[model samples]
Target: MLRAGDTLVIWRLDRLGRSLKDLIAWVGWLKERKIGLRSLHEAMDTTTPAGKLTFHVFGALAEFERARIRDRTQDGLAAVRARSRKGGRRPVLNVDKHALAVKLYNEREMPIVKICRTMELSKPTLYSYVRAANGVTDGPPAT
Candidate 1:
């Protein structure tokens, strides 16, 4: 547990806060409680005036870096959208595959396992296709 007049030593300053505003708030809080902050990687100590200034400067730079990263990610996403492309995995079941799975399920010439293996589909998927073909939206049929 941390107490007043205790020093909070950390491996890095970046791990202290999420953003510049957050870091400033934390620094203010520490100051009010008479707690010092020491960052080993940045070699910063908030007990001294110079160390405090350096830490603030580093916090500002970290915030700037994060903003730039956000801008780059947005630009990349916008470019992808402009090309009429979509993200995420492709659908597992399409019209043709759905039709074949339902046909195989209805014929009952093969075991469920064999049908799944032949169609490269899971047993649940095969059953769902059969249900959909039979006009069952979900669950067991009504009484």
Candidate 2:
């Protein structure tokens, strides 16, 4: 632990944290309290003016690396978007089945449950078709 007037000396900036962002924030907090940071291997010391420049350079490098990564990722996604047959499962209920379901639902006196069984359609799918055939666009069916 470091007191207000003490310094935190380490072998490398990496020893402070795994990433440059963490190191920058920690160093900023330490700087706020007039607490110094010294990295023995890099000859950088926050107690001196020149050492602050060294960390500024490191921060700039980290920002550049971050921007480069962002640009590359965006480019990769654009390439994927350009590929043929954009992904999603094919429609489960087709035209012929939809027509048959609509007919059974509208025509005979058969129960709705029986119609679903005859068409081999789920209750929800049958309801959706009935709603569409009657031109009801929003919300649950009337009954």
Question: Which one wins on TM-score?
Answer: 1
Per-residue accuracy of model 2 over 33-79 as CA lDDT, tens digit each: 77898888777888887989887676566566667877897787677
Off by over 4 Å in 2: 59-143
lDDT of each: 0.81, 0.74
Candidate 1: residue pairs that collide: none
lDDT of 2 at 125: 82
Please provide, for model 1 over 52-106, each residue's C-alpha lDDT reduced to its tens digit, 9 standing for 90 to 100: 8989998888788788987898888788889998755575678998798788778
List of clashing residue pairs for candidate 2? none
Deviation (Å) of 85 in candidate 2? 32
TM-score of each: 0.52, 0.40
lDDT of 1 at 25: 79
